[model samples]
Target: MSHDIDFAQSAIRTIKSERDAIDKLIPRIDGTFTQACQIMLNCKGRVVVVGMGKSGHIGNKIAATLASTGTPAFFVHPGEASHGDMGMITADDVVLALSNSGNTAELVMLIPLLKRLGTPLISMTGNENSALAQAADVNLDTYVEKEACPLDLAPTSSTTVSLVLGDALAIALLEAKGFTPEDFAFSHPGGSLGRKLLLKVTDIMHTGQQLPIVSLSTPLKEALIVISQKGLGMTAIADSQSQLLGVFTDGDLRRVLDQELNLHTTPISQVMTTQCKTVNADMLAAEALNIMEDHKITNLVVVNQQNKIEGVIHLHDIIKAGVV
Candidate 1:
């Protein structure tokens, strides 16, 4: 037995419907959208998002996106708000309500209370004439021509438009506030992104006695021992004032091996790479990784502005810290 259904065509229709719905939203991102953004931007407490059913689900995600991107926000289920969660909202906050019908009972029921508390209301609804939209300080019209659902009863294209609009609002606010990737990383500190943005060379570099160091007069053979003992595959050659002069790495060792020079008798300065790639201790570890990749080297010597050796940051240390 075979089915007549064209699964790919059905999916394509749904995707196109949602895409077109999002395109319609572009024109709606005008004065009202700007007013909504201004309200959230001026909010001192947080952006409290509330909705019912599918709208509620999208509201949760929108709140999270706002929170992670510099605008502090959180979701409050409208049903729960009627009971006691309403207290979570304050006059300092700005309420962002999501309802395709514009009159979700749960959300609408809280309008009077929201108004009484002097909390600014921003609504995303398909109907501009909705009670929620009328009551809101600003309304974002997320109207959709039709649902992607064949029955046209399910929240399909409308929900997609709401999600896209929510993302647009968050990103616009983020840009207006001058939000940076570093600021975003602070909100997601446990992830790899956090490590990449927050971990500085000083945080991962081998400092103090842990740094493999050798003097200009140290024998090439002795510097090799320091490299091995420190297990960094490299050693920094500094002057008597601890000023960085050069660096000797495992790669350099390979090149030196091809030479007939006596490792035991030759001074490290003669064999070390004088023009070494170095990073400041305060430089982001991710940036250090970029420098290392650009130079095709595995380690970097951390130096101060005065050319004084501070620490050694290895590619391994960056990888271990999840900044790679």
Candidate 2:
């Protein structure tokens, strides 16, 4: 009981401290934040993020968020920049330097070279009057009242503020550029997000010989044979022009059996559902999943603008493609 009480007290204190820091930070989001966002939005090239120690870790994440959200960006170590990495900076690019004290020696040494290249600089610093802030084209104040560390040395609140400010700048630029989910997915094509946004119905749907389809005039037994042979649990009923007319599934077969209909003599069109849900060939797989989930169905017919069946999509296809 004593140990639990101690853990709870410690957790509470940390939360309160971070909360206080964040509350203090709210008032600092003013014209300076807007100016920083503008610089990045107007940049013709990438945003180069540079920092040291804990700030460097935050800078790396900031760069990643910016790149994925439509702003081209990369993280460059300040120490490496002084040796030879400085060549990465170009006149067309914008440099976002992060430093809590605003006096990191390595970062400061690159200022002259950065200016010589005519690259615009935005400084995220706790000290507004430090060398970095003074030399920056735009200074974003990320000052924190104190670190959450009991000793006030381990960078907690300061790093949080810097990271949150970086996120603010990235999101602001994203809005200004009118970036969409499709654009974001392009940048993250290897992840699940990319699969969700970039995967199309055509990419995963069963087409050509794999599509289970039968003419509307096909006998119910023949349609059941096609459905069994294709193993889709459903078959599309099309007209002479190959236009989709309806769908006959296992559910329909069961209902027809209950009615004592003669499967051998009945036409598939007589038992097929005329009002089935269909998707376009070019629609996103995510949208297709939504339709299946909303309609509480497992299978869908992929059609063209003329309502001709092009292919078929199932819940299994979406699962295989990692859209779910």
Candidate 3:
């Protein structure tokens, strides 16, 4: 076979091997997984994750997932833990240790100190009988049939399985705690996903004098001028009390033009849409986007619980907020 063909075949075999490894890991989630989740869930302090080498990389990601999903977690390098990083651990913290061989010297050596501090240890190892697993309060078996590596030396399938296992644990705890999207947003405020879940119409809507608003008795010509000045493409028609009466838009102008209505003389109330869709100021920005798309409209009148005009939210506002 040519060199390129050999390389392609090797890549395919590696994928197939890892796929089978994950398939094997499916049946490994049992009471032990529950026990591990329970320990971390009931932990008063934090879940401190530690691993050596390749396992350490996976542990870092696992720690992030756990922390984002409502479980407080942080990763500490096992090799560094012995060199004074163990001070980061405490009596109230639970330790999650990952080691494929289960006899990794750095992690195993700290079992006694963790015990002395009365900190619970959860171990993920390929071997159930290994010293680390035996020393742990809960053991999560991450055993795999074989390595995807051709030499069976380099870490490959094992690391992938460990990551998948970590995800399972994080999600399980998230559901157990009734974690909500708003709760998740608190952990990821800088991300677009967080903005979508956390942002409200009140956060991005055009309010106060910036709102394109006109009285019901105002001429259509003047309402169009308000829309042009505010640049929101729509204007709210309200009463003296600021109670929402209706909405007039560029689309309303189009239809009025088609009907040969004179903008200079027509009352805006006669041309405005009385049944316009509206959203509460407190509504999630994402929900407002859904409302706009569902009604095939671009702007919504934001109101308070009293149905008084609060502000207006445009499709552009939601999109700019990264909610769309």
Candidate 4:
């Protein structure tokens, strides 16, 4: 209810604090960080992340990032691990533990169990010498000078540093594994990325009766009719053997009208675009989109190795397929 309260100033201070905390982590990406990555890279099983409270929230995100970026990982709550979820972890797995204080009771309790299983332990902690960090095979120091919280009680700056460090580890592993965008798309099959990477021109092209095709000897008026009937705004000019010669589009029709040419008598080949763009059946739809964008064309002719017309791809098709 204090109208004059400086909420903006408080927010700016908090942002600066977290930014500083992240900056401090740059020098700490040392040999220990490399050792942790090597351990996880050699892991035959998943990287099991464990944390409690605020750290637990950051751990969940870290696990998801790892899984999406070519690293096999999942999160297990520390409290649940003590009860029975410890069964989920194996000797072949590596454990990633997070604790700002490095002395979280729930996480510390699982240290003995993890050690007994002979699992490699990697810890992210604000205190390098705390119980959890001391027990870790490779410890990452996530220490910050102070919390963004004015009272220095809330988990603010510490959580941001941990999240950034986790992201760094995930990216490093991703690069080491040579993970490609196609591989990332496979993990996210239901998203737009999958459609862009996996969907091909053949999957959405109009073939068979839907193809707008006109012969080289066909009259311009008749070709226009075929284009109108096919609703593709263009008609491919091909020979008897279905080998593409050229294309006539709505733009060509406009140019013909300007010249007062006899549409009924003029042949389609006389006005067709000889250097029309064409894409292969196996080409990615996203690549097709780039071609369309670069050439400022709406429709593309799909052809085979012999330059035979196979189908027609429209901008609307790629948009409908969600590759755009």
Candidate 5:
């Protein structure tokens, strides 16, 4: 089949036009946007995001973004609200309604009830004079010059503007609330981000007898045995008091071989790296990864406040745990 170059060119032109529209829309995020943010931030309860059709889809994403970014929010379809879902809204909550036309009948029907409940309403709309916008406590203008669609009928550019506006609102609230990576991690406990931000050395490190360890006076052969059995490629060398003294790795074995030292007879401590990097068990796994990258090393010993070896973490363990 022959490719339609015209279709591709038309699509590219549409995208460029939409991008230009969005660029112009950025300047409109001024006092009114700030006011909307203030209202939502000071709201005593959750944000109820409501819309219809394509706007509803965008509203759902907006609600999720807001919820994950430290704002309490949930999407409530306007059609559902006309039924029993309106009960989900309360006097303490704030409603964020999305509509390009700003006159969606299902949403307009809830304005009176929302006002009766004393809930604040924020509207994202292209039409400022429309009922939804005029009735709202704050109006966020999401007007676009035209839809990316050649016919100017499809939601394209308008929906993109609305989504970007929603992201702006979420990020503003996130910054206002001082929401940190640790807080975001708590809200996203099931993903790789959660592991990186929330999981600490203690959560994944091998402890007790599982830790490959050898006394500083142990023979190189004995240390190699510990490393082999544990399959960690390294052994923590500790003093008689069990304080971490150094680390012996496969790299050290290579150096030992180069020096013609007999692994069977030499003391492991003689070839170990004394200034090995160590981390606290309470440190985030992401932070640990940074240390590893910065030091150009793979294995790290989890140490206590007293600098005694508590556990060990290999780069492989971090990868397995989805921390990096």
Candidate 6:
């Protein structure tokens, strides 16, 4: 066979082997999965992950996923644990140990110490009957049909199944804990997701002197000037008490032109939309975008409890805030 042809065949075989391994894992997600999730959910301290070699790499990623999703967790290398890292694991913590053979020397050595600390032990193992599996309070079987490696020496498909299993457990615990996007944002305040969920209308809305407001008695021509000055494509009309009366938008101008109404002589209140949608200043910018999209409008008046216009927020502002 040509070199390229042989390489392609090898790649395809590897992919198919991994696919079958994951398929087999689907049936293994049962009561044992729920049992593990319960232990993590009830854990008040943290999920202490321990693993050796290739499993340690996957364990670190699982720890990160769990920490960001609501269940606080951190990884402890099994080799290091034997020296002094074992002190990081506490009685209030739940230990999640990973071992393909379920008898990794570095990790199995910690079983007695974990038991002494009175910590709940959950193990992920390929061999269900190995020492680690038998010693764990709850054992998650990460068995696979075969490794993707033709020699069956490298951890290929086994690592993939183990990583996916860790994600499933983390998400299950996240759902059970009533984790919300707002809660997740708190965990990742520096990320784009945090900005989208945590930023409120007031944070981006134009307030006070920047607001483009016209009185209900204002002429349509003058209101157009206000809209042009604010450049928000719209202007709000209020009563003497500053209570919002209606809104005159560029769309309304189109409808007015259809009737051949003279802007210079017309009153803005005559053509303004009285039922304009408004959002609270404290509402999330993402939620404001949703309201604008639902109403098919680009601008929203930010209001207070008294129905007075506190500020204005436009689709552009939400987009600029990276909330779109």
Q: Tell me which of candidates 1 and 3 scores higher on lDDT.
A: 1
State which candidate has the highest lDDT: 4
Point out where model 2 deviates above 4 Å.
1-5, 190-194, 239-241
- Error (Å) of candidate 6 at residue 54 is 1.8
Minimal lDDT window, size 10, model 2: 1-10
- Runs off by more than 4 Å, candidate 1: 1-3, 190-193, 239-241
- Per-residue lDDT tens digits for candidate 1, residues 187-216, read 999899999999899998889999898999
Q: Quote the lDDT for 236 in model 6.
A: 94
Candidate 3 structure quality by residue, lDDT tens digits, 230-294? 99999999888999999988898889999998878999988899998999988899999998889
Query: What would the per-residue lDDT of candidate 2 be over residues 1-324, giving only the tens digit for each residue?
Result: 353358778888887888788788889899888888888888999999999999999999999999989999999999999888988889999999999999999989989998899999999999999999999999988888788888999999899888888888888888899999889889988889999999999998999899888887788999999999998899998877779999998888889999998889999988999999999988999999999999889999999999998999999999988988
Better of 2 and 3 by lDDT: 3
Candidate 2 TM-score versus the reference: 0.89
Scanning candidate 6 in windows of ten residues, the lowest lDDT window is 1-10
lDDT of 6 by residue, 68-92 (tens): 9999999999989999999899999
Taken over the whole model, the C-alpha lDDT of each candidate is 0.93, 0.92, 0.92, 0.94, 0.92, 0.92
After superposition, the stretches of candidate 3 with alpha carbons farther than 4 Å from their true spots are 1-5, 190-192
What shift in Å separates residue 185 of candidate 6 from its native position after superposition?
5.5
The local lDDT score (0 to 100) that residue 315 gets in candidate 4 is: 98
lDDT of 6 at 253: 91
